[model samples]
Target: MAGLDFLNGELEELKRQGKYRLPSVWESGSGAWMDIGGRRVLQMASNNYLGLTDHPRLKRAAVEATEKYGVGAGSVRTISGTLDIHEQLELELARFKDTEAALVFQSGFTTNQGVFGTLLQEGDVVISDELNHASIIDGIRLTKAARRIYKHKDMDSLEQALRESSGYRTRFVVTDGVFSMDGDIAPLPQIVELAERYDAVVCVDDAHASGVLGRFGKGSTDHFGLHGRVHIQIGTLSKAVGVVGGYAAGSQALKEYLIHKARPFLFSTSQTPAVAAACLEAIRVLQDSPELGERLHASASSFRTRLQADGFDTGVSETPIMPIVIGDSARTMRFSARLLELGVFAPGIVYPTVGEGKGRVRFIVTAMHSDEDLAFARDALLQAGREFGLV
Candidate 1:
């Protein structure tokens, strides 16, 4: 309590800079629209890419699971929490991912920690993209492995990192399949080719890519047809799957290895059986109907095209997650507030989430958004931009 006052000063400074994160209260399920601050608004800020959060099938699956099993697993997975439904979910996940095995974690962040902290050790090397997610960065930090970071999507730099790590016992090239803030994709096939030449393992965190890329939303590996070549494919059940949890799909040996060694998996309580059941049903729905993903990408593409044509700098986005770069953080925040006032829920992204002078208001397009919704969002963005002089 004696030193707590300093934190207030820091927070005040953030507010003065308009870099403070003031999250809105959401009173409704995420979909094409959401209730925020007692007002229903068009939501362009969610990761519910396929709009499965309110799907009757997913809801029914979750309800049935909660009825059959209690609300929680009640213990860590390594102890008394490995429910039968958990195994079933893992099996289905493996099948869906076309992998030999799968192990679910409490979250996407924890999944990264589980893999990196367990598989890497002293004398190992981790080659990461400079723009990889913070969870990946923290996971690498947890290991004693030598770390080398390459420029974003720069294969030459990646090769340089690999070349420098040749003496290590094991080398890993880690990247996000779809970069969340920028919405660009890592060149997985190229990364794989480099990893092969350098005898490195490849780990792609497909958190954003899942259910948004590939024929049936199998993600970057399947999108590029590099299934058997990649070593670790990490994903989340929350975003596109419209549930909650994370999983790493790989060889059977890999799953067994993580089961024993991944601290996050061993220490955290298992995902509730209901969540597992819902996620399982989500995969089944994706496999049964490919239109969901197709619609997602189509909607995103249309939005991005319209935004660019209407004079917004989309900043190299190729996926559903797109950013409207408004360099000054304060101005970006103002733009976002103006957007919210005008009935769009697109929020501002600021440093250090993004580079200095590159703060933006990121927009995520989902299948839930129709053509009318897209047009409405775009017009709001344009009006807000003009109001704030961001255009």
Candidate 2:
């Protein structure tokens, strides 16, 4: 057998550069507080914005579905795996998103692939925000379309991309509704206006925005009141919905088209009965009780305000995901470790995730975090920040 030793050197280099990471082991559910390394820590690193992961209603729904339908779908969705519960969840998702229809995928990353792979083709043009998620980037790469990237949240840059892509078979303007690393919202209204002028399709990946933005957490389209104007909306159940799946919402024709054309949807097994039912219940929970989302925004605003007041450079964050910018990757990793030692679990974000020289710890404040929990995180961050001269 050939000795594969080169990968070891690559990994060692990553460790030396402070970019190597072993994911933290969470021994408990992703609640505001979680068990990590046998210690109960205040969790500020999760995307569970609505804290529905342990909601009694979601739990009950999941149990019931599992009892009735067993544990797995057993085949690809295009085959024998499409359950009635799956269709039901899709209906609820469409209703929540105010779209003509919706189609669920195995995960958010794959949802992007499915959408971009299915929709974009040769002679097409894809205009993407430079800071869009990796999934979006990979999805675009999978196509034969002409790709143009605009500066993050820069409408002028987006217009320039659109202008350059004119006369393509189809033009797309794709952006994240809320940027995950920085927590800043995209300039959607301006993007929409530009897309309209250029006759381009508008696709918003609302993975972080769902259940964290808009009235009743209908997502960025609803937040901007741009209903019926935007073309594609991508959302995730794994984050705020407190389950595991993703969906794309658009016209009924789009859903039907993806059902046939999207490789992920056609190839991957359907979302299990339990997950589908729980997601269906999650939508109901968000729609019926608006307080969940309100609490999330309120907590995020309060925590972000406190962080900013302490002179932390929380660049352009207007949402729950907060990144405390520290330029050096090694120092950023040290800060994150120190925070973990102090019982706050926020992970470091470094190169390849964000650009080199832009290293920070990403903190996600959920609705379930109590005032006391917030204060604990605040003090831990302050102490860590002081040691690193960040605050």
Candidate 3:
């Protein structure tokens, strides 16, 4: 058959299996409210946890940097692409993470890909949380190392994998700082203890945790007081920092080695000067203002309490990333549609993003949302649930 025909056939199969996903288009900047195809809606699907995406400080910094450095880095870091701004951003990230060193990548996904593929070799083993983000899984797949998956947040299962991998030349336990799907925190302290006992390196993907958890938002390691125990700390600037790109924090030697060996870092152009400068400003904003974090947590608490009180089945979510479980994919989709009609913009999350029979409408709260905004969302969601016969 023709190539287009084959592609269409695969897409049809995916649709028939209830696994095809089409994203909605948004025309405005990310905030508590957004414009979706000309309709204004209360956005509860963004990872802009701290709501800094359109902050004046970040915009000014980005604009100034663009004027000074132009649009792109023009080359990869290993070649002549390591701009002074890139170095500054790396140093700032290292200081913020309290790590010996840091390395910037084109994105959070590539950071995982580069770090994991560079560190693990044929005889090595990677024990990862089953629900880890796709980037980590893909990164492991790119490596020659053996991969073992443990039940999500199950320390005993992780220990078993670690114990079974004793013969491997190297063992690394990888997990998300805060599981994106369920919004539950990883048992990092237990994982750290196990890593020590098993002589394994512990790495955490803090994509969702960096700008929302810990004191001054230092991420899961600081949240659990693990500090120097975590061998690798990966995070993104696109989420709460409300910019673009990603970084990995670790010992100076590890970063130096990745600089020379990691293909993505060596081959990809560095992040634009505007993005790097904006990220730096965002970090400064987070550090100087504790009110943003407090407001975000308060909004999350309020929403969670109201949802639970109204009898919505919110799973074990302790963070701003909450999910209203609806089991059936079609029903979850319908629920999200109803929510959209009610002027809320949370999207349905179905299989592949989650496991089978675990479809839900994910709600993300932001610090920029006022009490009225949250109250409006709660009312809208309750109405949608009742209309859909969910509650």
Candidate 4:
């Protein structure tokens, strides 16, 4: 009871910092337009970049797989639950990524944990970008590896860290392919150069980049034309793939190592058969069509360009994710609430998600949105932003 009491104190501090958040329950299908609880809203807060969550092909694949393999994988993958659909998904992902091999995990967060938790050792070193995901930070902690955080996307800082870590038994340089909050891509070509100069293993978490960047959505490696240079490539099925799971694409040896030693993968039950089938179908769709990603980026550029002309602070965003910086968390949250009431569901990213005094309402543009949707969103945004004094 005494230990549990600490939660109240922590939550109170979070509230004081304006970092406390409670998301609206999204009950209906997630797409360009979604039903939040019972109200319909134009979606902008999701990571579903391609708007494939409710696609017909994915739906049909899920239904068919369910009819064939039932609802669940009966046990953990290492036990007796590695279904044919699971293997098929892995193979397809490998092909999609143009990697030597691929291994699926239950979620992107877990995929990070699995990779760092298994491949790294106590004396190994982790050189990470300061703005890497929480999953990467937690994964490093799980490995008990020494970590050095470089300034976000600063190659000079990364090279310094790598130089300092030269004497370590093994070194890993990790970064998110895209910074989720800023929507700017990591300087991966520079990172690859630094890693090679220091002989460090490079790992890129492509959660936000997968199915949203590169030719046919092959993610950051393909986006930068650094296909075989990087060592570990991680991705998600939940975001652009519009399904639910994660994966790591690397050498066949890396897959074998993870299969044997990754505790999360070995201990947790595998993803459902239908999820595997749905994810595979999602990959196929992405491979067959490049127009969706192109259109999504174009929409994002138009919105950002328009917002900037209206005197809104749209920070360094180069992708479909656009953030309207407001500097005050309470005001950002207020802007978000008013916008939601006005029929858009773009959410606030406050301290901890961003930093103190740099709060914003982050928008994720998708391909499925029509011209009417964009026009409506522009008007809603202008009115709400003006009301909140953010514009």
- lDDT head-to-head 2 vs 4, winner: 2
- Tens digits of per-residue lDDT, candidate 2, 1-391, equal 2488888999999999988998788899888889977899999988888889999999999999999999999999989999999999999899999999999999999999999998999999999999999999999999999999999888888888888887899999999999999999998899999999999999999999999889898899999999999999999999999999899999999999999999999888888899999999999999888988888889989999999999999998999999999989998899899999999988999999999999989999888999999999999988988888877
What's the lDDT for candidate 3?
A: 0.91
State the lDDT at 13 in candidate 1: 95
Candidate lDDT (C-alpha), each? 0.92, 0.93, 0.91, 0.90
Cα lDDT for residue 315, model 4?
91
The per-prediction tally of clashing pairs is: 0, 0, 0, 0
Off by over 4 Å in 2: 1-3
lDDT (C-alpha) at residue 160 in model 3? 92
Question: Per-residue error at 300 for model 1, in Å?
Answer: 1.1
Q: Please give the lDDT score at residue 370 for candidate 4.
A: 81
TM-score of each: 0.98, 0.99, 0.97, 0.97
In the predicted model 3, the residue pairs found to clash are none
lDDT of 3 by residue, 1-391 (tens): 5657789988998777666778888899788888987999999989998888888999999999999999987888887778898888889999999999999898999999999999999999999999999999999999999999999889889989998999999999999999998899999999999999999999999999998899889899999888889999999998998998999999999999999899998888888889989998998998998899999999898889889999998999999999999998877887888899999998999987888899999999889889899899999988988887778
Off by over 4 Å in 1: none
Q: What local lDDT score does residue 210 receive in model 1, on the 0 to 100 scale? A: 90
